[model samples]
Target: MNCEATKCQCGCDQETDQQKYEKIAEIIAKYKNQAGSLIQVLHAAQNIYGYLPLELQRFIAAGMDKPLAEVSGVITFYSFFSTQPKGKHTIRVCMGTACYVRGGKKLVDRLEDILKVQVGETTEDRKYTLDIARCIGACGLAPAMMIDDVVYKQVNPDKLETILAKY
Candidate 1:
């Protein structure tokens, strides 16, 4: 679906990274002037570039005739808008009260050791990024962890070895 926004008259016709920037601008132009077009443009841009870099944000703002602060605000307000590139796999360890009391901290530590990267960091191979979450709404399955979108419940330190092998 074309994003509904008004196109600005910014001169983005140039070579180099600007070309890619203009390409994203064209997609935004299609959705110009439409209500709720911000998300659509952001989604389209991210889909094309993997992540929403600051340069692309500036380009989009200029092409859409929106303020840079407005564009930045929308980007920051939405969790779906990622400013950094994401890894192929995302591992989230829940550290809620129930999970923590159930040895969730040990599980997170195990993962960090095995992955050779700390929480909130991607592996050197870019295969995985480890993150610690407050809760995943899986209290019944305390000490839960999510690999990508699949929730693994009742995780223990011993299970880490087997799980790491699979990935």
Candidate 2:
């Protein structure tokens, strides 16, 4: 299957999402003769598209009269930027010193078992992606994990079964 198709198997049109590319094009046209439009266009494009694909970057580069290499360089340099699509649900485990000492590793293990996927991998259904971060500035809530933007604090191995059951 071409998962990259602009339309899904159920005939759900994703052109609404692709329309974001056209919106970017409009923004580019508006700023076609302006200076420093590269960064501005990149921001608008990323905002609309979620992530900047190579083709979008090329379009922006051409619109701004900039080289693809320069646009590519800027995209690569920013940690906030991404080339890949993100999962619907983002699961982040905190491996900070406090969380780590408070059974964070065990929590991670349990999550892996429940999700049937290793860290940094998406579930087979593409609903969730497991990620590990060094810290989330939540030392007060040690042994923490986050699903989407909701935080699960003081997580324990035994709670894994019940926690996953809700999902």
Candidate 3:
């Protein structure tokens, strides 16, 4: 949740994010009028700001002398890059053939209903972010999902509330 007292509603302190963005801007400036630094700069920016919004993307584009279209294209091309804020806890649902066939989508639906947010979105309280992964590899244990680093194999959609409560 955002601290209403802080000027920046983001998780990080306002001054700290300013320092970080300034440093990142410096890095982007190094590649001014250069090419092929879009990916690297976006990666660094995401690392610092968690996600890239239009304002920040504009900042990066101007700093690196790259077109906003090019930067936005790269960001959209890669599913790994997120334009929206992620929650404190990330929940990934596997959608591989095995898992899909074994009720993975159902589990995702259950999670969405429980959290009241669609896939790739964070709950209003910023407690959890739901994501869909092509495969989390545990095919043998089909219908797998993970919260942060902990993997839950053979998840039961009916028990999501109990399972999530442990977190």
Among these predictions, the greatest TM-score belongs to 3
lDDT of each: 0.82, 0.80, 0.87
Candidate 3 total steric clashes: 0
Scored by lDDT, model 3 comes in at 0.87
lDDT of each residue in 1-167, candidate 3, tens digit only: 25343245576645455666787888787776566778888988898888999999999888877789988999999998999988889999999999999999999999989999999999998889999889988999889999999989888998789889997
Model 3: ten consecutive residues of lowest lDDT: 1-10
Could you tell which candidate, 1 or 2, scores higher by lDDT? 1
**Residue pairs in steric clash, candidate 3?**
none
lDDT of 2 at 92: 88
Give each model's clash number: 9, 0, 0
What does the lDDT read for residue 82 in candidate 3? Answer: 92
The order by descending TM-score is 3, 2, 1
Residue pairs with clashing backbones, model 2: none
Q: How far out, in Å, is residue 99 in model 1? A: 1.7
User: Residue by residue across 39-156, what tens digits does model 2's lDDT show?
Assistant: 7778888888867888888888898889899999998888666665556787889999999999888878888888898886778887778788788999999999888878888987
Worst 10 residues of 1 by lDDT: 1-10
User: Which structure is stronger by TM-score: 1 or 2?
Assistant: 2
Best by lDDT: 3
The RMSD of every model to the true structure, in order and in angstroms, is 8.6, 3.9, 3.1
Which candidate do you rate higher for TM-score, 2 or 3?
3
